[model samples]
Target: MNQNKRFCLALDLKDDPALIKKYKEYHWSGQAWPEITDSIKSAGISDMQIYCTGNRLFMIMEVDETFDPKKKAEMDVNNPKVQEWERLMDQFQIPLPWAEDGQKWVPMDKIFQLA
Candidate 1:
């Protein structure tokens, strides 16, 4: 199997069950907005997956060797579609308390890995 860098990040959903259901719906492949996926690929993300437990969400992204989070973030800032998608998603997402202001999907520390 090929090896790639993986980034793990976490965020929380609004506590309302209805909102949580809506959030999950948006993540369904059939329901996902294509522009968002396109932007991710253009940002050098080879694969992306999201998981949820209760209101907490965990995102795993497999990125190309050249992927740079800062660069991707800068690109996202200039992409109207990406901004729109983020605004729509903001309805259901909440930053973790430990996250700095304006931060979303805070990066998680890697505690262990199997070799």
Candidate 2:
């Protein structure tokens, strides 16, 4: 990644225990995670990491300036494999009340970072 690149995203989770359990099962079972991971890579992101604590899921990705969030979002929507993966995941997702319509995962704005 270029030194100037920046990437980060945050996804608020559903407090429902059932939803959390279901998400864990799908991710650890390897039924759909590999494809989803690969799709992100195919889109030109790097050094991605996912973290969950309590009801928040945070993802830090390394992406160059050329990366366009809208384009990436469209790629995810256009890919059948990605679409299916998302469909499987919809059951576990809960939209945040503060988010705009149809937004599930909300991006975090960077406030400060150390080099």
Candidate 3:
């Protein structure tokens, strides 16, 4: 598993039911998951899955060791479609109670790995 170089990211959704409904609608409207999965695959990611439970979204992405996070960030920032997607989705996202301002999605740190 270590050799595979997969990373997991977890994020929480707003507790409000209306916000959750908006979030799901926005996500589904853009057909985002499939497109994002395709983009990651084309960028050399081997496997990916996103799951939601109790207002939490967890993403597991299997990426090549050479994958460049900086490049990915740049692409995301510069893409108009991505920008629009974020803008639409941002309406429903609420920062965690302890999150810093302007931070809605927080990345979980990796603490353990399986053999």
* Top-lDDT structure, candidate number: 1
Stretches of candidate 1 above 4 Å error? 1-3
Q: How many residue pairs clash in each candidate?
A: 0, 0, 0
* TM, every model: 0.94, 0.79, 0.69
Query: After TM-score superposition, what is the CA distance of residue 84 in candidate 1 from its true location, in Å?
Result: 0.5
Per residue, candidate 1 scores C-alpha lDDT tens digits across 17-85 of 999999999999767788888889988899999999999999999998778999999999999999999
Question: lDDT per residue, candidate 3, 1-115, as tens digits?
Answer: 5656767766677788888866766555445665555566666678766677778877787888667766776777777766776777776666666667766556668877697
Residue 44: error of model 3 in Å?
Answer: 3.2
Ranking by lDDT: 1, 2, 3
By TM-score, is 2 or 3 better? 2
lDDT of 1: 0.93
lDDT of 3: 0.69
lDDT values, one for every candidate: 0.93, 0.75, 0.69
Instruction: Give the CA lDDT, 0 to 100, for residue 86 in model 3.
Output: 70
- Structure candidate 1, residue pairs in collision: none
Using TM-score, give the best candidate's number. Answer: 1
